[model samples]
Target: MPSLPPLLAKPVDLAPLWLVERLARLILSSVLKAHPDLFERLGDYRQTRYRFSPADLPLHFIVVPETRQLTVSRGHPPVADAAMTGPLVLLLGLLEGRCDADALFFSRDLSVTGDMEAMLALRNALDDSAIDLPSTLGTLAGPFSALVAGAARSIRSRALAERHATWN
Candidate 1:
């Protein structure tokens, strides 16, 4: 059998908006559940929406840490909170907790704007719970290894489905 590529490892290419939205939602859902209090800090943003866009080689995540919550369509500045310029694969690696968040910044593999305060809130909220890939994999896996396999299949499926859909 051919070896599987690293999870989320990728070359530069335009991503399907739906897939990107899905991934962002998944991450936020997990984050919110883990750190409900984190959202509370956003004075009025308890019900705000945010967007992530990858411009250039790095992924730019723009968001307001406060409660006013800025989104792609309704934000004033309409710029990213912090620009994370680096390998997309590495960002995925970091997200999987395969790499330490601090270390990534130190190594310059990732960057952030609201990271200082935003990360503090994130860490405070999610420092305890970790992603239990074993369970996630058991719930959604084929014959291949769980983590990488499941994720790859999920991404591929979403990509194909999105491609087949007619926007009209």
Candidate 2:
């Protein structure tokens, strides 16, 4: 496949942020509805702002725990209480609890900045919860939930495989 020039690639890369942002908000809303105590577990950090950056993509997401809002954009904010950065696969793996946080951090595949404590707390909370993105998103699909979940898993697997292939 021919690579897109930088000028063209910029917009192409940014396009997904819009779709991702909308989907993220919907998923978050469903998650909050299912788990009302999500914010309560966040404690003082409930009000803290967290930024998630996907290193391979031109995208960032600022999440406000208190408001239960997640804003996806093309760049990081001026400031964030805590920021976690990694490739999209690593981020998804962490989210799905399929990857070991400690191993990723130690291996430098993932990074955290600003409020370490808040990040740790967030990590702990995530660890305690059963967050299956595909299943979660499937729930929103109602009757087609299983099919949606299966497609999501398939897409994720293919993306991960492609990413791994590039590393070799």
> Any idea what lDDT model 1 has?
0.42
> How much lDDT does candidate 2 score?
0.75
* Residue 140 lDDT, candidate 2, scale 0-100: 95
TM-score of 2: 0.79
Model 1 TM-score (2 dp):
0.45
Cα deviation in Å at residue 1, candidate 2?
Answer: 21
lDDT (CA) per prediction: 0.42, 0.75
- Candidate closest to the true structure, highest TM-score: 2
TM-score of each model, in listed order:
0.45, 0.79
